[model samples]
Target: MEKRVKERREGLPELPNAEKGKVILRFAPNPNGPLSFGHGRGVVINSQYAETYDGKLILRFDDTDTSRKPPLPLAYEQIPEEIEWLAGFKPHLTIMASDRIEVYYEHAVKMLKMGAGYICTCSADEFKQFRVAKSNCPCRDNSSEKNMQGWEKMLDGTYSPGDAVVRVKTDMANKNPALRDWPAFRMQDTITNPHPRKEIGSKYRVWPLLDFQSAVEDHLQGVTHIIRGKDLMDSTRKQVLLYEHFNWEYPETIYWGRVKVHEFGGFSTSEMRKDIEAGIWSGWDDPCLPTMATLRRRGIDPIAFRDFWIELGLTQKDIAVPLSSLFAHNTKKIDATAPRLSFVRNPDAISVGIDADERMSSISVKSHPKEDIGMRKISFDWNERGTDIYIENEDSTANADIGMRLKDWCDIGPIAEGFSQMTSLEPATELAKIHWVAKGGASPATLMRPEGKQLHTIEGLLENHDFPIGTIVQLERVGYARIEKDGNLIYTHD
Candidate 1:
């Protein structure tokens, strides 16, 4: 299996210009909500490279867009926790961009004084026209001193939101208009849209965009490598230009094509947040959501989750995969230790009459088929006629005529009343093997199965076992599930 995975991944390539114990990698995420499956790729890939080189991994929160993509207060704590869970270690340094507004302001002032940045009072429409015409905006020719004056106005109340923006001086004739003079800093109305952080709430209105903030942060942190999605290549192009202005060496960048998990393709942090506000989901850890918390709640081993992405490696070709791929990895990691139990959904009761000589009072079954995990004894209550047991409704009458083996117990066949015990302990080869729980040993259970956006519940009876809460167990014919509570089980996967 290891060999197959290596061949499939083609092995992760060594980082360029990387030195042992010198490489520094970072995973920057917008802290709007808990990290989802899409975000895990960055965390895993960057952390893996950091580990391979014995380097430092930094967790940076790009939470400066207080108005457009406001940072959720809870996400401040959730992102680091999720990263630690996925990476198997806490980052060497955790920095929040919101905490360093003054640093960004200092850089902005330096850029303006160096004649590489200008404050533009042009409306968005006016700038778009200039960009489309491949011509410079009027503000491009402003003197550094004049731009600094406008910058002060932006920091104060003189320039309202959208009335002024600081633009990075780039070529207006650049083939890609988006690569033209892009907005680096803008004024925001903190009064109406205050930042979630109490200390930083409405502190200042002038804010730096992602490109400016991230570029400066990466340089300051001495990041040696950056692993980001291919969609952000334009960000790299823009940042490279900014680096040229500062005469800074840009980090080696690696890009992976978008990985669209078939099950979670429709999920977005913003949309999920809106739904969560409307009470559409239970919370970030809801069973149906594709969040790290949800996966942890469903009993997905963190090692398996990490291995799943590591095996995928890095590629530029966009790939779509099903959730089953991850489930397969998880099964291998947990199956050997997951206890086997009987859970009959939509249970149907049946009485099995037994001959006096064939009476079996109790049956002991191994909790694990191939391991010495101990045994569970299921006792039967016998009457003058027969003993009662419960089996899945679908399996009750399917092979009555041919008879069926009550797993770990004797064989039984249809009779006038219900079923009659067979004399032979070993059933015929063609006989169906069905799981059953003696009436006395059955406990009510509810199995929650997540199918896309909907969570379905299956009422059933689980064999009375001593497995503690959070235990991952495999139901005979059903799939693997986690014991959420006394009578609750959340289905993980088949």
Candidate 2:
């Protein structure tokens, strides 16, 4: 692992000496959907930083928009669940933004009285058009009384959804487009919650912007240091402004760039969720995804993930590291720990002229080839009256010329019938390296498919080879496999 990388990354600016006691950090995920791998990175990074400084980590759900696609707060549960599952730790506190709507409005009223915020009677489309064309709204200079009346109308459900919104009223000509008078609260039915707010029938016509509410909420929660993706680094000014408006101390911020697109295309956590919901992939933990759970399911060690993540360190410049590095690093780490087992995917059985009923000829195979490990005993002979022995079509063909080592036995050349035949195995072992037997008395072996199904098979060699459970050994020219249990094993190309 890169110790220097972690040290350097953590060497960021700390809270000022005077503000040391107020060290609070928070991770606000709007549990609108299942937690994604990218979010996993954020959770770990933020929580680790909080722990480093002995600060409290608050797991807050920014579930302000109750009108989300998934109306239920999947995040409230999934966020904490995924964080615990991946980080092996939980936050000091859990809060939902919906629960704090009163607090936000109370603060919003303060801003309104300060003349820093105003309610506009602009519709959603009008606001969009105004924003696009840089047109100033007539409500921009409306009297405080008029704005308060508009807010009252919003509270009573007298105004329509798009009839009014509360804007921060920042400069439209600000150099940063994001700082250009962004909306603090808006009337919308993004998600309709039946829960009463300030009054009955008071569906929040004015919803607080995530960044704005987050700033105040984080301050209230006493977050001292905030870590976020670089994509959001640009919002620092506005957030800082909000903090100033609330007369609250702003938290120190650390920004890390987004994870690179290792493949030819970019697939973010958000994009992956969309695809999964659209039935493009299996689920959030789909092995093809870069999610933490998916990595775990794919047998990728957590330590390897941490090492890889820190190796990149905290940088403002986004990077596109090659995918090969991740795979290779995982392979090297698992080589020493993961147990070895054999699996032939597409089976091809052949008759061998070996001795029948020969129990005296014991085959002893080492559990792990690289280490001096215990061995397993095997008794191989003709299959009752048949000479059939199964082997992977891919391995059989690849080693056809350079006969493969038959576990603790002799190396034999494959017959032309194996891969050379018209309907036989291909020239390479790619066709079938993972083959298994039906369950009988043997331990249950599992074949974890790409779609997330686990097919339990039997534990035993296709030929005379024998290897004990939890043994890290090679399949004699085949790839690597981890003996999950006595009956099942997980195979990887590495």
Once fitted onto the true fold, the runs of candidate 2 whose alpha carbons sit more than 4 angstroms away are 1-22, 68-72, 124-136, 190-205, 264-278, 355-362, 371-377, 381-387, 398-402, 413-493
User: What is the lDDT of every predicted structure here?
Assistant: 0.90, 0.61
lDDT of prediction 1: 0.90
Checking candidate 1 for backbone clashes, the offending pairs are none
Residues 1-494, model 1: lDDT tens digits: 35453444344788889999999999999999989888889999999999999999999999888877899999989888888888989999999998999999999999999999999999999999999999989999999989989999999879899999999998999998779999899888899999999999999899999999999999999999999999999999999999999999999999999898898868889988889999999999999999998999999998898889987888898999899999999999999989999999888888887777667778789988998878889988988767888888788768666678888887877633465666467766667889989999989989999999989998999999888999999999888999996558999999
Error of 1 at 90 (Å): 0.6
RMSD of each: 2.6, 6.8
Best by lDDT: 1
Candidate 1 ranges with C-alpha deviation above 4 Å: 1-10, 356-361
TM-score result, candidate 1: 0.96
Residues 223-282 of candidate 2 have per-residue lDDT tens digits of: 777778877876778887676676787777878886764542556555666887898777
For candidate 2, the lDDT comes to 0.61
Q: Candidate 2, residue 142: CA error in Å?
A: 2.4
